[model samples]
Target: MATADPSNSSSAFAQLTNILLAKGGYESDEAWKFVEDLFKNIDGKVLSSSSSVYKSVADGEMVVGLSYEDPCVTLEKDGAPVNVVYPSEGTVYLPANAGIIKNAKHMDNAKKFIDYLQSQDCQDNLGLTTTNRPVLKDVQIGDIMKPISEIKTLKEDSEYVIAHKDDIVDHYKEIYTSISSEK
Candidate 1:
């Protein structure tokens, strides 16, 4: 199995950490220890980038990878003999976001664009064009990707994650570096 390096891919690291935290009963101290212990014990690879993690799996360099859903689905569609599974304990859903810049010259156009992003046509089109799941229910998100409703998702404490992000990243890096050095 492969996991992303936290220094280069904070979002992926955070998502993975969030799931670990949830599975460990949201206990920060114990979760941190568990994460460190897993890294120390598992004969796993730590890829420098999240893309590398998925690519390693698809290319048969690694058997399992912790990566975001969309690319894993894409790899499966490309017939890489990969399987995508949402952790039954719980998984994190990191939805892509769009926001209009404040004081934009074309306020009306910006609003229209936001509306278009949420439109049924766009939502449905995303299902066909990309692995990004549609926000609207009863919309197709391709055959390989599971519907959000079907997945057991854990609610992340965003504020806490945000507040401790830097510390968390540093701690993870420390553990990773220590293990790599020992090897």
Candidate 2:
């Protein structure tokens, strides 16, 4: 198993617990306990994703990676022998949003691209072609891609990020160092 510091890695499960804790009104100690268990037993690399965590996994430098579903799907599609698994205890779904830059050099092109992405055709085909879960009604995803509604997602706590960002960062560092030190 491999783990990466959550601050710099989108794949890291740093805020994974917030979903569960958020509904309980930011009960962080419990959340920390849950998060700590994820890394407490890892026996692989403690590195940043900056060094290409996916590539390392492909090269067999790591046996398992705690990551979001997209890259894993892409890697497998590109011929890397890997499997995707959800945490047995359930996991969080962190949605990444996108926006067009106002100062982009190709403003018109950006607008067009965004518009195209929002189109019916794109929405209908999104699930099959991309890792993103489509927002449109009645779109079908692959059997491997579980429905978000069926997923056990931690409820989002709006204030948790603002209030606990530092604490979360510290805990992430502590977990990584503690695990790495064991090696």
Candidate 3:
């Protein structure tokens, strides 16, 4: 997971939490209420998102975000395995792609950068350091990160990126503005 910048808009945090909860079968209103309640009196910014929340919860912090309610129930009691579950609700998948501009002067440099990024050494480093999934077929991620083979459900029915890119961007911008105004 990326290190969240404290300066980032709260709306980004809110939207991230909202998406996770909605996907995890929690009602949107209820999820927002939970967020509000969780951070009601806190002064320092709390990490708010499924990934960060899961990490925080795993580390024994009072974090709240989307997950299988059962996972939370178990973690709150049994305290074993410690996995974060994304519920099988309305999950939206966002697949990323890399492309170059139609007319680029630094085409060679771009290709070199992409080639370097796809190298085995780079992939291995990325796997150990961040949430980046290796795109190269031959790159072995080893035990540092969760293997793609282990994530059967995600492979089976991953959501494609939003079809209406412009609309989605506009909607998120509006949401960010609305939430930031309250801060």
| Residue-level lDDT tens digits of model 2 in 113-136 | 988877788876888777667866
Q: How well does candidate 1 score on lDDT at residue 68?
A: 85
- Per-candidate TM-scores read 0.88, 0.70, 0.42
> Clash pairs of candidate 2?
19-154, 19-155
Candidate 2, backbone clash total: 2
Give candidate 1's whole-model lDDT: 0.77
TM-score of 2: 0.70
For candidate 2, give the lDDT of residue 108.
Answer: 93
Q: List the residue pairs that clash in candidate 3.
A: none
Let me know the TM-score candidate 3 reaches against the reference structure: 0.42
Off by over 4 Å in 3: 1-64, 67-82, 86-93, 155-161, 164-183
| Residue 33 lDDT in candidate 2 | 61
Please rank every candidate by lDDT, starting with the best: 1, 2, 3
Candidate 2 regions with alpha-carbon error over 4 angstroms: 13-26, 43-45, 100-115, 142-144, 178-183
